[model samples]
Target: MLRLHRLFAVFLLLAAALAAPAHAGKPYQYYAVGDPTDVVLPQPKKTSLVLMGGGPDVDAAFAWLIQKGGGGNFVVIRSRGTDAYNPYIYAMGGARSVETLVIPSREAANDPFVIERIRNAEELFIAGGDQSDYINFWQGTPVQAAIQELAGRRIPIGGTSAGLALMGRFGFAALNGSITSEAALADPFDKRMTLERGFLLLPELGSVITDAHFDTRDRLGRLVAFIARIVNDGWAGMARGIGVDVETALLVEDGKGTRVGAGSVTFLQSVGLPQVCQPKQPLTYLNLQGQRMSGGGSFDLRNWAGYGGATLPFTVSAEAGVLLTR
Candidate 1:
């Protein structure tokens, strides 16, 4: 009886191990190009790229992108899991014109037609929602691969709020609650958090991550937390934290550079800092990398190293307003 019990336990352990790989970090293969900093523009035969803001104006952004195409066909995907309120359809003008592919659940993110649409899309847009839903549902699935393929083809991929969060090479999963100014100032490190790796297909934007509703939401503390995580993990020696204000968008052109729109984009760079972190303390012993030019200031992705001298010490309440306004 004892031997039989032990055998059962061993079998259970093996079964558990086998189950783990299904959810493990399976490697994603991508097409390679020379120069990590180089941005690849989509061929003219491909699709046009347009990343829009998530707000009352989201539809306007979409319409603008579609009109910009001069009658080219396009497809839009709504990643928001709930059908309660669809900005793409009702709020946005997408109600009658474009067919909105609504993935109301995480499981729907794997639909073959959805993935195929993304792969062949002239324009792909991720609608706003809780970004954590995106990380949990789409990360490492065929949907993610299709987005990567569209990006590689240089097609415009855009999102708002949660959707906007997915724009960066490294996107905050937002598994933790929304990082508000109060929470961020109180504690940079929040619980229920995990980072999504390799969601965006651009290498130039690697080591540079983004957050939305920056100043309005007081996301400085959260952005600081994100930077600290990157440094602590040694994933990249230096990283830039880009906080985009609500109603604002940053159009990244083939990774060659970024164009600011609507609100403003804040770039936070962390200079020299010890890799070690004490438990429960705002990441200390670090230098602030300094802010990027407010608005209309552009930097070559290849020459990002030139902006390294501007690190600032991480602060919970640093006041840097939007540099550009529409």
Candidate 2:
């Protein structure tokens, strides 16, 4: 009888995945692992965010999230993907159950039940997919409101890749697809460089934009170009760009950011306007303060400099759409 029940459950899961529509559509998808009932564990909470680069899951970082999450209901939310994370995160223990919410459209983002599922989360992880779906579907909707409330409650929240992209207060929306470092340096206003503000609106990440697959994708030049746009657009007097390498994660809390997993986390800051940044032309940005930290290093988010990382101040310039480095 137990074997029959297990087989039936697997059948149902396969059926659901098969039944789900492709892309944006009415109704949302949900999958769960472990205990069937939602458990709201009562415990003191403190907010922490994990900025994960696109790659293999960071075990230590997720463990930290589960720890900070109060060992309660862990929820994974994504615009696409399957229940893969559910079992993956659940196997890590500490959480009562792991659930995945597949919210695919603006209409589904407004669904009361969907919003409620999000509201009940103790720890929320935004899985990798297209950031545009999150922006177009959830931004300014009740879904956003629900997430804001969860953050207000000081729950552990995280994201990776497209998930990590929108974690910043200001970020590249990727609405027009991804812009390369070379293309961005050539023309900061390239159509592919579609940047936007006020997605997560994490005050802790004030005047900041984040990029993923940093080293793997060679995104530094583009991130610098992004800084130029943010400063030029009057978003803030000073702008910060955080680029996390593949398999790396930044565990942030209490005004401090610590590196975990593989590779290094890059921190770049721009305080002055670009000497030459305009549409249809190359870029000229100078003296950007940068720092690179490997595993176990910590950064002082408040002071913009901290122990355990290498300081790397650099400059970038372009001649007729040709990027030149110093």
Candidate 3:
């Protein structure tokens, strides 16, 4: 009788464990339909990065990413979502390889299986979600290190919206919360203007900061604020910013970037450190240059020069108040 009772207790526990949701007790939820072990080995190719603002991805841009993915073994990383992109990726026609992993916690982001998949992936895409979730969960984990390895191997990597937010050397990580232009211009040191760095250090994006949904969100003021912070904080000698509008993407390869989509991509270069940038004060900077690029336009990241578009020069100052002039 005693033996039977013990057996019954063990069976109940097993059943309870089996009934639990897959990936429960971990930091994230992971769902994959394809085999991660069956990925094709890495190949030497020009690594590319596609930075999409917030919107529906242009077909041409995704087509470009699909081609770069090589084979069907593409991987998508997100904080929360299903493998919905798999069908679309498979339709783009490679080896029919697509896998999606939603990592919700630091533990899940560092899971051996998750890290291994990321390392093996020929192409990786970061889905649009809360950038703060990304920073909080992925930073300082083996997952973050694995991404750096992928970049080192020259594999294709890209992201949309919040995912795109982290691709730059300096990121508006939104750790505290989203900042507004009014708050930022009012006080360049607003607590909401959280920034983070060192997630992925790609060469082409050195000294660069990125913003998404540029025009739609009217983020120019805030991006300027971010650039001000970078320079004032001694994060870089002078900071450069790229703001991509909705339905737009900047396809970057080598040291050059080409813009594509319906909206525009703006580049802002800080001539030098701000003359007057302090906590609780508006910014006063001279000769902050800017250029706007449309579809089929190109820009040299190394030189900050534009092709196929007018490289307009501009200045920003906050003597009495903030003023941007071309």
Candidate 4:
């Protein structure tokens, strides 16, 4: 009887241990190309910006803009989605004036026609898909060069979902989800996830980073995780996570600053977080300051001025990245 009781106690202890939540080993790290606050007003001759809602029929709206902007002969680059060859082609309807280029893979990303269409295009749009694919395939190829050239010429470049993610100077690759979800809420210090370098290099835009499906999907947690990774790796003293809710878009100008369009954009500013040592253990360091500011709300990017000012929610030891939506 005594032996049986001891065995039962051991089994109970094991069960309790198994019931506890498992902790990730470490957190992911994300890097930026430049500072977020630095806004460069483009030359008047070449300045155009566009934003697309995640779930809405924007064909008519885009068509109208293209026609008005003298972009009757436009080009659409569809790199994302399952049907890569004709990704998001329907979004334009039969807008006969515009031409479409569906790049199925990284190999096709550098096709001469693709490059020519992108370079000559007055407006460029990237379809929604896994952003990491954009980074992996087009980061340093001729297609990327053409996109940059279009930007230099002052043409509008827009994206949605993964497309939106690639717009920022720095972008999250979604390498692993373990640390991403947890770190967004609190400081989960185990830096387990790995980030891809130079994935979204928009140097002219500075070190701006962007994310999609903000409030609707409750992405606050993952945004915080991104900030933690940036701070932990000494990438930046402060980081900003721009969370875009579904069916919304934020319009950003070179010098005029950011403006809200269809939906709200949540800005997650991380000032501090609890320090942790190992996985599954409570954080020791506390006294962290995190704040959520929205576009056109009390927190205005233009009003914030440089990295340091009263307009900002918290004092950033280092400049945070910028985030855009659409």
Candidate 5:
């Protein structure tokens, strides 16, 4: 009886190991939540994007993403997270398979297997993690090239929090750690406000910077500061910023954006240039043309205007370290 009990214990351990996520840290790691075999389901794929704020997940936005993917293979890429997204995404039912790849280094990001999975994915998601990791590991590598290729094919792409930060043409890399709205407004050129361009080319999002957890984190001042710095850096004549509220997402299809969840999405642009945007000084931007949108109606990303009555327009400015509005 003792030998039989020991044998049962070993069987249970083997079962637990097999049930765990596959692949562990040789170079990279991956966990499959649904069907293990690769599959290409015959469904009409559509090109779309989701920028989710950091907080609770938005169910409607995810359902829309799955619908856009056309019930095909879904691949999620991240640098610091585990396979937590796999089972969550797989159970959503539009994807035939859900795979999560935890790529922590440049070598892992450039792995041929990793690149191939991204290239073939019908829908790809970037999980919330440190944006700097994504930049350092994936930038200039075959992984980046593969993602650009997938974008060229117009497949669905989505990200939340740090993931959403990089969807715009201009991304806040967050290399030096996070900077609060107070810190950013106090000094527009704060060293922690590291923004990068050409990392990922989404022409539709040209000259745009995205901020997540907008309402909950009070990130409006930071977003405004980011735009001020963009014009200060001469990247573009005009800079645009998108701030998504917590527990909400901005779904971009074609050139229009549809807000999802309970919170609002704020869009802002520099009036022209900051009056006093020098280093070690507070930003003094005269006017920031802005619009706030709720869960209804479509906001045009092309003209940066709203169609229905669900939009509210406001103007904001910063003087010294304080943000003011009229």
Candidate 6:
């Protein structure tokens, strides 16, 4: 009986171990590139964020990130992607050292050693991948807490593609799986239009939701739907949805956001409640404001005003479904 009980205990342990995330059993690898010197700062500065739309990276935004890092100790966090960023960050980020951490699971996210690296970095970058993996593995875990702590400390953080999707207070999450513009427009509350909240509560970004590969993917229609949901669901009386085009970057710093790279960044603000936003029914929204910002243009996030560009009015509905500027 004693032997049988011992065997049962061992089986239980094995099962528990197997049930852990895929990366739990595997070790986290840190790839280092370039000079491993320290770029020291006399004092910590306010936090800055670099939100990149999917596509080729922008050099101007990367240069800004490098400057914010104080020229050293840059870190890249990702669930999927190669260590190719190590060299790129080391060079473009102007860092004394660049390291990449591939954290693929919640268990890995809880690892104290991994958290230590995140906390020590002067600048942190989240790489592109499926944001769903990020939501499933990182949400409510120590990993999420650690990133939030970084933000609280005013550390600079940046991401591209899937990385950008996770920056806003409200995220699409893709929990029900990725949705297309046509599909989302057809039914505002389709299973695919999964929205999530409370993952990030960054100031000025708390009332904002983000979408990537905007123009290239024709995601404006869906982004409008997301804003309507935010208002209709009471997440915020007024919600902000930011859509970034391919190869573009929106740099948020000192309460201001600027657009750079080859494409434009569109800002969509819901004026009031949706005319129609029910499950299985088409969406109808009126008087939505949009601003198309290109490189060299800036906007005040705190005031929700545009300086270098114009904010145009757009009206979207189920029947006509046309994206117009007034």
Best by TM-score: 5
Per-model TM-score, in order, reads: 0.68, 0.89, 0.88, 0.63, 0.94, 0.87
lDDT of 2 at 280: 82
Winner on lDDT between 2 and 5 is 5
Ranking by TM-score: 5, 2, 3, 6, 1, 4
Q: What is the Cα-based TM-score of model 1?
A: 0.68
Best by lDDT: 5
Tens digits of lDDT, candidate 6, 153-266: 777889899888888999898888888877776787888888888787775688899999998888988898888888899988889988999899988887788888898888
For each candidate, the alpha-carbon lDDT, in order, equals 0.55, 0.83, 0.80, 0.51, 0.85, 0.80
Q: Which portions of model 3 show Cα errors greater than 4 Å?
A: 1-27, 33-37, 310-321
TM-score of 4: 0.63
Candidate 5, which segments miss by more than 4 Å at Cα?
Answer: 1-9, 39-46
* lDDT for residue 109 in candidate 5, whole number 0-100: 84
Instruction: Superpose all Cα atoms of candidate 6 onto the true structure and report the RMSD in Å to 1 decimal.
Output: 8.3
The clash count for each model shown is 13, 0, 4, 16, 0, 0
Q: Write the per-residue lDDT of candidate 1 for residues 113-204, one digit (tens) a residue.
A: 55654565555567677877777777778877787886676555667777777776677886866655444433445563466666775545
**Model 6 CA lDDT for position 228:** 81
Candidate 6 TM-score versus the reference: 0.87
Predicted candidate 3 versus true structure: per-residue lDDT over 1-326, tens digit per residue: 99999999999999998755456666655544454456565574676888899788766677787677666568889998676777777676664467778888887887887887788888888999899999989999988888888888877888899999998899999988888776887788888889987777976888889999999888888888888889889888888899999999888877778888898888898877878888877777666778888756578888888877634555555442365666
- Which of candidates 3 and 5 reaches a greater lDDT? 5
Candidate 5 local lDDT, 128-233, one digit each (tens): 8899999989999998898888788888888899888998889899999999999999998889989998787774688799999899889999998999899988
